[model samples]
Target: MTLFEQSGTWRPVDRAAQQVQTLSFEMPEGVTAFRVGLEFDRSGGGVLDLGCDGPHGWVGWSGGERSSVVISEEWSTPGYLPTAVSAAEWHVVVGLHEVPAAGVDYRVVVSRATAADVAAERRAQPAAPPVPERPPGRDLPAVDGMRWLAADFHAHTLHSDGALSIDELAALAVSRGLDVLAVTDHNTTSHHAHLAQVGERYGITLVPGQEVTTDRGHANAFGDIGFVDFRRPGRQWQRDVAERGGILSVNHPLGGDSCWRMELDQPTAVAEIWHSSWHALPVLRNWGGPLAWWLSWGKDTVPIGGSDFHREGSDALPGSPTTWVLCEGQDVLGGVAAGRTAVGVDPQGPVLLRVGDELMALGADGALLSTFEEGRRRIVGDRVVLPAAAGPWWLEDDHRCVLALCL
Candidate 1:
């Protein structure tokens, strides 16, 4: 095996600027596979979009979502071509976006394997785990003839940069106690066809959705609708998704590198009020983009949550902050459309429920809570019963952190 590793520093780049960091490596005979891993500081306002080129050209590209990938003779990561990784010089290109004034730093590791090593890897790949049938939505409460369905509306699969296949995702979702899982791959709906089989096998409601990932912003489209055109304008996506009876959401509008910077004069269908990124983004960074935008549009703007689950090593899960949707049937997207949903801290955590003029917590007792209505929110303690008219406010933790969005 041959390996090369190095640490490099990148100067501050403008909002849209490209930077290149190259590693020159000479290969010995009989090398069968080449793998690459790029690690960087996602905090401190530096987000890198990366692609690599071998002696030939175009090894792979994992935009922000992935930091490592393996390329073999016949197959590579999706969005990349798997061909002969000829022995020669190679280059890794980095697109620096949203860099802080202090500059960005990164580490690159490239490794090559022999035939025996590659064969061992093939044999070592674990077999897919069995997915158990899902039980009735776990820990959910029935409110006014509506049962709150727990769903993770944003996730990816091997069809995109996700490490898990559809089958693996199903198994993981079942283990995570999710009743619904939406596989919203980046810019493609190719995974939609397999949802029925996979979801049925796992006994969970599979929601078909697509992340219209673009350079400007990102959105999630959910439904049985066909492929959505990501190259189209944002308004077109909203119009087309609505026409197809699907729902759309501006995801992580205030995220670091994945922030939704696009401006569409038309109203947004929904907004990701609580994304897992909220807790992890750099502290220096302003994490109030989507909330500010939603407030600008008033409380009518439907809100949801997505962990954007791609893997397990990270603290993020399919429903780290579970989305509880009020559904008459098992249709999770239908609840999203009707704006009868609230985002909670976790599957087993507190979920604020609004039944008529009364406010209550489901599965949460003595948890710090608050209330939000109109554009303003006030922090309330562990008090269970909210006064009348205070009934319509979102529940927040101390420091106004989003505990459960009752609105």
Candidate 2:
């Protein structure tokens, strides 16, 4: 009963660094145990620390047959863990106690395995390579009643999985003319250092974030920097995220053959409507699939899009659909929370959303359709046009609110 599913590399450091890096992600439910596999260039490597970060403090650590100082754990080339996780994001940290100065690169793999699967070496392989990155460009042209923009909530770099660095991603976002950008790595905030600096330097709002991981699935809880231990109970993780005022979102909702299910149904903050992984499927299957319809009409969740690029080696490209945020500024964090956003499918071109005193349409053909005005309603062709309500109004596409729209 693992809560989610995952398959991919988790290394987050370069080869030249003196210290090896540790990676963690939220754990899936019904994961009775776990396994570890390490590949190093040197034989006499330093000690690598492996364990889980509990809410109170350190709960589990490598020891005895379970503790090997070399490049891997001692339990089984791939360590075995028997723990029923709680309903929170748990932390899985891998520390290299004493790393050797190996000029060559190295990698350590950690994954969940059922007791039976371990007995049969039944571990799922990670997902395929990341798609191209989004090209950079400008603010969307402003319309009388609506404003159009582009955004990407999920992005990575050489610091994590993206092929580019923090500067490059920020530059690309700026060049692509996107208004919002969120950098989410596997399980670390290592990219924040450069991302923050470049974001401010380049006038791009880089959302400080981490891809809170689980053995079962992954969530992109955006906003400030917070921690969720993948090794602890799952409930605690969710509480911590909500308690801190962060918006929790389901990443790649239809991934891993639907192995990744939200721990809590009907998520509040974000549910990835457009992602690179979703591109492999057909277009109709992309949004019209049973799962898409379920997440859309059933939950009415906010739609977000991301490249999910690891930045391993190649360039970054927007795989398919893209998220368009109609934020106030280039501030990724501020605008995203404000709900000025929309998502458009690839080949469908761009979409413009407005929450103004009057409902006006500035079509690509330069034709204006005055559907409704302040405090008035009208019927235009095949559509029933309602005036902009005096109270709170929501632009369904970008997740933004106009004056009176209720949250």
Candidate 3:
């Protein structure tokens, strides 16, 4: 069944000069194409610029009103089709000329066009069918024990900037036995439906989120269940995420010259310390020089890592040194909210993770332990200690570098 609906407008609000609107949505799996519609009267006019965020670069142009801008049509952006966007948060910038004329009305619509075969198949299915049973031998241990509970929050796909498809990403997540996967596309949540579809088929939790990126830097928002317009800016959007019960993360705050300096000034749950595929971004040279200084000052902020893979030739890889978050139990959303997430070389690899005083350790076989007491590491034991005090504990692993946190 299709998990997305096409055609919608921005929340009714006043427009002003140099104004920005950010829209957030769950670009579920199975969506192949999408269209965005903007409707606003041309008044109080100067020039209106229209642009939308994409995987690698931004699209559309900020120019006059009354004309429609096709976001993904023909060679809109080089090497990328103006169709089939990855699932994640998306933002559209409607640069108003001279403040919208009083009482002017404008709305934006995003639509997806599916091939006849997929449409026919979709018509044949009732509501999402009962998930197919898993093949034998696939019955594995709890994902938390296998260190599959943690995963990278930032990544891309062929839908936009990344090279892989939604199905491929899910396969990787499932093969890794990830309990939760956050599909963060560049600027649009078009791929979310596909993530959710494949995730359910594979028995995993696919959280909806977006990478609110700008020419300056990028940020990610997880746990969102509805359409969030990242196109609208200000604390209201941040507040909207909180109101919707989502986790907000500032991505790769230390990346480069274009990196956003404001993440340091705002309050957020986590930050991306390691974003792989940096070599592909020649435009932003010296991306790592200032990261160390920023990290030193923001040690208190949670650290999450990702491959930041977009497609091939893009500045991210499928699993090149990604991150993971270890949740003690289900409720993936809760884990992210509690800062029980981790991003390192490989979250699924056998390793231990220590965040501040809190720690979590994973065994080569995927067993997990939480502790803070400095003592001999325990392995293959039946008895596990629960925290007696009110604070985070250590996550340990004998093999990999303390992979992630257990909050």
Ranking by TM-score: 1, 2, 3
TM-scores of the candidates in the order shown = 0.67, 0.54, 0.53
Residue-level lDDT tens digits of model 3 in 317-350: 4444445554665566665565555543453344
Model 2: how far residue 243 lies from native, Å: 1.4
For every model shown, the clashing-pair count is: 3, 58, 79
Strongest candidate by TM-score: 1
A best-first ranking of the candidates according to their lDDT comes to: 1, 3, 2
Scored by lDDT, model 1 comes in at 0.70
RMSD of 3: 12.4
- Top candidate (lDDT): 1
Model 3 CA lDDT for position 204? 68
lDDT of 1 by residue, 1-407 (tens): 33777777777643335343445666545566776778988788788765566676545456666686666776555534565766667776555644678877888787875556556645654466786655455555577687877888889877576888888888888887888888988755557767898888877888888787776788998887865655568888888887888888888887766777776757675788788877654561234555566677566777788988877887488888788888988967778887788887778777776665766665554445543434543434433555446322555444555567666
Better model by TM-score, 1 or 3?
Answer: 1
Clashing pairs in 1: 370-396, 372-393, 372-394
Residue 33, candidate 2: C-alpha displacement in angstroms: 31
Provide the overall lDDT of each model, using Cα atoms, as 2-decimal numbers.
0.70, 0.48, 0.50
C-alpha lDDT of candidate 2 relative to the true structure: 0.48
10-105 in candidate 2: lDDT tens per residue?
232432342324455565545445554445443555444444543334334341123321111212221222234443565545544444554333
User: What TM-score, to 2 decimals, does candidate 3 have?
Assistant: 0.53
